[model samples]
Structures are given as C-alpha cells and as structure tokens.
Target: MRKWGLTLLAVFLTIILTACNQNDSKDEDKKETSEKTSQKKEASQDESGEGFKALKEKELNSQRNKKTTNDSSDNQIIDYTDKQKIAMLLFQPGLDDKFITADDVLKGEYQSKFSDGVKKKHLPKLTVTSLPENTQMDNTPTGTKFYNIQPFPSQYSVNIAMNEHNMIIFGSQSPIPDYNELLHGLDGMAKVYKTKDVIKSEKDNPKLKEVEDKVDMQ
Candidate 1:
C-alpha cells in the first residue's frame, strides 16, 4: 500500500509540471508577437517623419535657388499657361488675406476642389460679371468668359473649357500672392501638368485694348 501511494504522488507531480511548461511557452509566444508589432509601428512612423523632413528641405532649397527673369518689352501683357492658371487660382489670397502656401497644401491644411463630397471652403468664391460685348480674347478657351474685376484695378477673365472638357473656371478677388510659392505648392501637390507659358497679347484680344484705352482716358 505504501509503494502504490508513492507512485501515484509522482504521477500527479509530473502532470502539474507539464501543464505549467505548456502555459509558459504560450505566454512567451504572445509576448514576442506583441513586441514585434510594436517595433513595426515605430519603424513606420520614423520613415514617415524622415520623408516629410526631406521634402521640406528640398522645397526650401528650390526657393533659395530660384532665378528671376526680366522682360524688356513694354507689351503690358499678362498671359499664363493652363498649369500656371491653375496654380495662380489655387494660391490666390484667401479669407485670411494670405496665400495657401506650399507648406499648407503639403501638410493638408486645405483640400483641393477635386476632393470628393467637400462642401467646405475648398475653392475661392469670386464675384463674376459678364465679359464686354464684342471683346475677343484669343487664349479664351472655347466656353464662357466672365470678367473678374474685384480686388484689382485691372479686369481679367477666366475661360471655362466646357467643350474641350479639359478645364474648369472659378473666379478669385485677389491675385497670386507669390509666384514662387505658387509654383512650389503646385509642384509639391503634383498639380502642374504643363510648364510652357501661353502668351495672350492685347493684339490677340482686342477687347483688352479697348478696356485699356477706356481706363487711360478715365
């Protein structure tokens, strides 16, 4: 009877030790998985921070190295390409009497007009009036032309290309705050598609000449 009791005691001890070992193994595995997940999250955040820093440095360098050009002609013509037009429109003075800087656009301070379901202040709401009768602008896209005569003494028009389906127009009361910042922001946002400046001389737009003549007379 005594020998049988000793053997049963040993079997019970073995069972308890085996169960404890299994539990310890499971706990170790869970801890390792949690640690790996934490490490991955930290790495991702670090990469994002580095990328943002690099981009800001590149933009600053570009601004510092930008060149200035002077046109000797006295044409007094204001012309821009499709890409420039878009950038100028985007960076025009805002409600705060400031431009949407490249940093703002890059940092997601303002959403683009192309953003979906955006009812907020995504685009500038300019006051629009009809163009002068019988005045033709050569660069005017094949659509409607409306004169924006606010916030500036000189009147300009924005053409909406409905027929071509390549452009959309909205008016702004203010002009571009900084051309360099405009180009920088547009480039940062990957918004510039074309770089050539499309010139629209007063000779091409006879109405412009008429308006200038009237202004000079006044």
Candidate 2:
C-alpha cells in the first residue's frame, strides 16, 4: 500500500509539470504573433506615405506644362499700318531710364543712341511699341523677385509680334523691391526672349531702322 501511494504521488507531480511547460510555450507563441502583426502595419503606412508624395509631384508638373502651352498659344500676331507705326515712336521717350541710368536701358548706350540716327534720317515709317509690365518666370535657385521696363503706356500687358516668322517682343515693367531681384529678372527675360530670329534681327538691323524710319519726328 505504501509503494502504490508513492507511485501515485509521483505521477500527479509529473502531469502538473508538463501542463505548466505547455502553457509557457503557448504564451511565447502569442507574443511572437503580435510582434509580427505590428511590423506589417508600420511597413504598410510607410508605403502609403511615399505613394502620396509621388502623386503630388506628378500633379504639380502637369499643371506647369499646361500653363506653358497656354501662354505660347496666346501669343499671336497683330496688324499695324505704316502710319500707325509712325505714331508708335512716341512710346520711345518712355523707354528712357527715368528711374535708372542710361546704361540701365536695353543694350545700354547702343539702344539709347539709336534715336540719333532716327532724328537725322527723318525715319517716320517705324512704329515702336514698348513692352508691357508683367511678372516673369523665375529660374534662379535662390528665392528672388525680378522685373523689366515696358516701353509702352498701358495698364494691361501687351504682346508685340512683328512678322510671320513669329517675331514677337513682349515687355513688362514690374515693380521690384531690391537690386538682386532686378538683375535676376532681367537675366531670366533675356533667356526667355532670346531666339534665332531676334538675334538675326539685332545683327542685321541693329538700329531697328526699318521700324524706326517709319516714325514721324515732326
């Protein structure tokens, strides 16, 4: 009877130890599963953030391209007669640097002195329309403001195109707060307006004599 009692006690203790070990193993597995779920959630959030950033960038680029296309399309040619051209010379006086120096004008002394030849030649067939003032596109990496002096007198900005070769001269007199902005703005304008036809016109007809001669000095 004593031997049987001892055997039974040993069997009961063994079964209790086995059950405790099994419970510990199950707790560890539950903890591991929770950790894996948390990691997957974080990864999903990161992917979503990156995708949103890419989408915003794409939208901004599309808007910029659309604006450029519309501006180019709107710049069409206009009709002006020889008499109308002569009247355009009156706008030249406004081209004088009222706020800046003679060197401040386009091409500096060269453009300024072109008027002398006009006075001597009695060129009354040309019409000179100054460019209208408007905000130019900024290309510099540094944050800055820029502007150009429009030769014409008007509140609304005007687009000046001379011939079928798509020869156009657009001008805008924008108010700038500082000198750096002016320089940057002028540089940008030169880059945008610079074209093969314009360069050739400047080279062949530096004085714009054809246009100048049409103006009536008297």
Give me the candidate number with maximum TM-score. 1
- Point out the worst 10-residue segment of candidate 1 by lDDT: 209-218
Query: Which residue ranges in model 2 land beyond 4 Å of their true spot?
Result: 50-218
Candidate 1 per-residue lDDT over residues 49-113, each given as its tens digit? 88667888898877665532224121212343332333333332331222333233333344333
- What TM-score does each of the candidates earn? 0.26, 0.25
Distance from true location, Cα of 55 in model 2, Å: 12
lDDT digits (tens) for residues 137-196 of candidate 2: 333223221222233223323233332232222334553333334334344331122223
- Evaluated at residue 73, the lDDT of candidate 1 is 21
Weakest 10 consecutive residues of candidate 2 by summed lDDT: 97-106
Q: How well does model 2 score by local distance difference test?
A: 0.40
> Which residue pairs in model 1 clash with each other?
none
